[model samples]
Target: MQLIFDTLTGNTRRFAHKVADLTGVEVVALADADPRAPYLLLTYTFGSGAVPESTAAFLGQHSHWLRGVVSSGSYHWGESFGRAGDVISAQYRVPYVARVNKSGNAEDVRRVADWLQTHAANAAD
Candidate 1:
């Protein structure tokens, strides 16, 4: 599976690259992705739990190959923190892989890496 991502403050991008480094999965920006291959989306949540308009637009046209989602946000948002993952996961019928705090800690990377490793074969199909 590909690692597709969108970022504003670069936290999501950093996280995506870290995961890619561990798993050797290809990583691409939302604008650059082909979306013909299965991918896990990594993105940042915008205002009050809203999905970035770019992400929503990308999904609008090419959600068919989406396999899962991960989102980045501060914990301060409480219920709204990383809610983009929830929204995308529900709308696309894919797993909500993770919610990372900012760029995420090493443990967070490890957990997401493990999940990606576990699901790699499934996404290939």
Candidate 2:
């Protein structure tokens, strides 16, 4: 599966690429993505746990192929932190792979990598 990302401050981009480097998943920007296979979306949360408009637009076309979601947000947002992933996951009935702080840490990368390895393939079925 591909790793598609939408970013405002580049944290989601950085985190998506880090996950790509570890998992060998192809990474692409939302603007360039036309996913033919399953994919995991990584995006950023905006005001009051809202999903970015660009990401919402992308999902409008591509949610059918989505297997999971991850999102990045500032930790200070607390309850709203990375809530975009939760929103997308619930709406699309896909897994909420992670909610990362900023660009994320090694542990976050590892968890995502593990999920990609173990769960992403199953999603295709």
lDDT of each: 0.91, 0.91
Q: On a 0 to 1 TM-score scale, where does candidate 2 land against the true structure?
A: 0.95
Total clashes in model 2, counting residue pairs 3 or more apart in sequence or in different chains: 0
1-125, model 2: which lDDT tens digit per residue? 88999998888999998999888889999999998888889999998999999999999998878989999998999899999988998899998999899999999999999988897657565
Alpha-carbon lDDT of model 2: 0.91
RMSD, one per candidate, in order: 0.9, 1.1
TM-score of 1: 0.96
TM-score of each: 0.96, 0.95
Q: How many pairs of residues collide in each model?
A: 0, 0
lDDT of 1 at 14: 95
